[model samples]
Target: MIRVHIARQFDVRAADGRRLNAEELHAEGERLMQSLLDLEQCNDDFCDSVTATDADKGTVLVELLISDETETGAFEKSRTIVRTAIHAIGGATPWEASADLGADYRPRDVQLEYV
Candidate 1:
């Protein structure tokens, strides 16, 4: 299991180029997050649970908890899936997102064997 944190600030505007009010802006963020969770499939296991919070004016903080039984590298794969989903919802690429496994931090090399 792994956790990913993604935060983004949006410029909420309507078709008439009018800024959305606090309620409208919040609703838009909620709608976007729901859309992301509704995707059937993208890369690997989709996020099992997600939390979206209005950090501040036009800013939303999205935290995703991802887990998969089929894929060992679920963390990496899920990150890619999240990015794609965000883009689909008109969200900016989460280039600053962070993902970590548990608390220990270590770099390891991997070797794949195929026969």
Candidate 2:
């Protein structure tokens, strides 16, 4: 089995020093995560989970758990799902509002087989 952990982050502030409600933001994050799962076939052998936490410095961390039967297409599927979910959420690319969901980390070359 392959278990992938993705962290999507959102900044709670605007340029004017305004802040977003944490509860509401977290809910939206959760919804986006669910949307990603729903993008896949229901019968697919994947176990998904989500978590939202505070960075203690005014940012929110959205963590995703993707447990799949194998490593094939895992990275691509994740990108596709997340990209679609972002469009559904705000009519814009998710990258516009959040940091790299995975940052500089990627699956080990041996464990991930795209083909």
Q: Which is the leading candidate under TM-score?
A: 2
Per-model lDDT: 0.45, 0.47
> Candidate 2, residues 1-115: lDDT per residue as tens digits?
6766655555544333445356655565566566656654553533453535353444544344455665545555555555566556542342453342321111121223221
Residue range 19-85, candidate 1, lDDT tens digits: 5566766665676577667763442444443534342444444444445533345546545555555
Off by over 4 Å in 2: 1-3, 10-19, 40-45, 55-72, 94-115
TM-score of each: 0.44, 0.48
Alpha-carbon error at 73 in model 2, in Å? 4.0
Displacement of the residue 70 alpha carbon in candidate 2, Å: 8.8
List the lowest-lDDT window of 10 residues for candidate 2: 102-111
TM-score of 1: 0.44
